[model samples]
Target: MKTVALVYSQHTAQTAELGGRIAAAWGSEVVYLDPDTTRLEDWMKYERFILGTPTYFDGELPDSWDEFLPELEDADLSGKKVAVYGLGDQQHYPVSFADGVGLLASYMEELGATIVGETSTEGYSYEHSVAERDGRFLGLVLDPTNQPELTDQRLAAWLEQLKVAFAG
Candidate 1:
């Protein structure tokens, strides 16, 4: 299995918690990297990455992720694999639920990274979201605020898919 780095914003409690859970579920090969303090060179060390973020007010990317955009843009991720997970409140912001995942995935794809682990949108109640493409979420979309019960199951399934995707 390829070494995977789970990158997230440590400042956002929900995102941080989700990142921890993902890392634990992924086992020892996964390393946690906080985007705030992770150097640009550090990002190049891993070819497989799981990025987590909580959608801020009205679908905005959190501050730490927003600030790290330049570094990501500068990095060369050609042939790399990235899976994104985003936290959002589907009940409160249905129109923009988990848009951060889409935004980040798009940027990474632009940088030549192959985005993986897209999930079905069947269980979600969101009206609209940039995260949806071709009727599926760009990656895992967890609504812990309204549907915490489903998070674990969703994470498990997504992680399984990622293992296969990253292995290639």
Candidate 2:
């Protein structure tokens, strides 16, 4: 089985929801880390990462993730595979508000994580399974209105990719 570290800065319910999906579908153990915990081993042991969070203001980066990124400046994840996802208010903010995934992608780059690009707009997967599939064709449209349920197929495929990358 694979092990994935789902890191996020959000309410416990949200974090748990996402982590639960990953654990169940991917046959991977899941770890939920909030904004305050240390990420020292996260980079080494976990071959892949799923970063999640909510949008604050107009696509502005959350302080916790911001701080966390700099903290990882010394960590080496250059060859690891990483993907990002986020939940946010679509009506109240700019489209960029949902861009935490991108910021996290960039942050991983700083740490040497070879990003595979952002994952599907999990928000959509929670609700529209069809939209999630459409994402496979459209490449990541980032639907803020969509609520996605981390499906088995989706999680399994993602895990398989990371497993191959890590197998070296």
Highest lDDT, which number? 1
After TM-score superposition, the amount by which residue 37's alpha carbon in candidate 2 deviates from its true location, in angstroms, is 0.9
Using alpha carbons, what is the TM-score of model 1? 0.96
Tens-digit lDDT track of model 2 for 35-101: 5665676546677666665556666567777777766777878667776655554455444545565
Kindly provide the TM-score of model 2 when superposed on the true structure, using C-alpha atoms: 0.64
lDDT of 1 by residue, 110-140 (tens): 9999999999999889888989999999999
In model 2, what is the error at residue 131, expressed in angstroms? Answer: 17
| For model 2, the run of ten residues with the poorest summed lDDT | 125-134
TM-scores for the candidates: 0.96, 0.64
lDDT of all predictions: 0.90, 0.55
